[model samples]
Target: MIKTRFTEMLGIKHPIMLAGMNWITTPKLVASVCNAGGLGIFASAAYSPEETRKHIREIRKLTNKPFGINQILIGPGAKENIDVAIEEKVPIINYSLGKPWFIDQVHAYGGKVMGTIAIARHAVRAAQLGCDMLAVTGHEAAAHGDVATSMVLIPLVASQVKIPLIAAGGFYDGRGLAAALVLGADAISMGTRFILTQESLVHDNFKQLCLMATEQDTLYSDVFDGMPGRALKSPGAEAMMKKGFSLLQSVKSALEVKRMLNLPLWKFIGLSWSMLKSKEGKGLLIQARSATGAISHLKAINEGDEKEGFLFAGQSVGGIHDIPTCKEVVERIVDEAEKRLKAVGKNVSA
Candidate 1:
């Protein structure tokens, strides 16, 4: 293994990361990745502060090794979630969207902040904001990200930012990790690859579907969750593509969002106004505002609504075939990456 800056910086044995996918990254999954020497992140964006802490406690129970928490800094209850992470003393905080005013707070406790970005300007801003590292997610990532592909964005951001960079999007095998390293990232963050693992909470049917898919199976559309995202196109997504069909999904999704946020219109509208006041804040707020279908999509994931709800996935699904445990998944990637890196020798640089 290269044992590059990433491993030393994070005090982990491998330079691999589990990208946070809401609801799908449960405590059991997080512990598995950490135990295997790769960093696993729990996605707390979909949870209330209490729930976030609950999951963190569970992860701690499973492993004493370090793990991270991924939070959407502008999502509903973002501040509260941050508070919970800090209070629980997580080793790392991974975040994206909105101002990074909480960086100082995280640093105070010796916890590092890893800001995720796809575009160049955002990466520069993150570096300037005192983030300890960066996770540059590209178009191939499962959820919301800018148009830049990992091939183009990775090196570009690396050239501009001084902090360590972790590449996300379409990373599965060792060659992908080598490619990420060649592009100037110290580590690689994976989403779709790990989502298929047995430890992941993604539906078993969905995991099988990913393996059967091809690179062409995925697409970027606002139909599934209203904001631009990549996913497997099911009947619900196709129906949403039809004019006026999405509006109904929109209505149904909004009802669920309100219930989840516990907002009673007046409070929701007030928070909306606060988010719109700042340019960066507005972008995140607008995305979340359009995320009506996202809340409903979870129903598809956990409740088996398959044909009627959204299922967020990446273009990488085509490469997934079996549902291995999270440790097996991370271990396989690390093993493959080490073999690939070792075989490449000096020509691979580093």
Candidate 2:
């Protein structure tokens, strides 16, 4: 009875969503989150068209519940991955980095498109582009924020967009969800909080660090991925800060993402340039920063070198202390939310 628009809109039992973390949200993890009553979002940015489908099938095999896919539209093979998702008739497609040109296609299939943005302007752009929902991520989010924290960004975007909004960043507890609802968001998405779940497949070392973190432990640095993203203060970030951008670094970083996507040279070059051209303004500068920072982004996923690799994280890491199962995590937050809502209702009645 404490349902929000998120539950009604997505047709899910709970309002919580698992943010797609690259190299971390495996099929097992995705299914676990879904089974636990939260919307599980698989990170398809790390996979190709076929690989994405395979994992989607794998998750389906584990649970009959609905789950979404997170697609980083700026990376190479992004278009192809989007095509595959459309063809497969995925339930929800969450995208970041660029405008979605395939919204109509997804709409035809009854699929929802949700754009993730850290800044208010981007949120407006996402709504204009016909996204069904907005996941308003803030600077306190683990990765890639232009500006604005959750408290400011959510309400700003909510004022502009007609669709439902989900708040991300600085969210890991029932209090965060209550605050987001008060701010006009229908629900909340959990990145760091989901990562702390037992189902996540990340490095134990990194997980340990996350457990030890506090809200103050996160730092925003362009050295992470040629863009300002939030993450735990680590030695890798420190080293990258010492180095600066160069043409060689730029090409290398582009190639790393390309290799991951298995994209041909022409498509890779064309799309990369296209994103830069469309973004224009400060976006071009953010794209340029990728030259020195991109390698660290990809390397961090591979566990190649912590000294050079950067982990995208959020300020909420400090608020987390244990690795609960996905179901427990979801139920805990949802239950708390329901309790608080009912308590507030009683006060109103009184």
Any idea what lDDT model 2 has?
Answer: 0.79
Q: What TM-score does each of the candidates earn?
A: 0.92, 0.90
Evaluate residue 232 in candidate 2 and report its C-alpha lDDT on the 0 to 100 scale. Answer: 75
Report how far off residue 184 is in candidate 1 (Å): 0.6
| Clash count in backbone of candidate 2 | 6
Best by TM-score: 1
TM-score of 1: 0.92
What is the clash count for each candidate, in the order shown?
2, 6
Local accuracy of candidate 1 as per-residue lDDT tens digits, 185-255: 99999888887777777766666667787888876876655457787766665665564234454556555
Compared with the true structure, all predictions reach lDDT values of 0.79, 0.79
Model 2: how far residue 105 lies from native, Å: 1.6
- Which stretches of model 2 miss by more than 4 angstroms? 280-306, 348-350
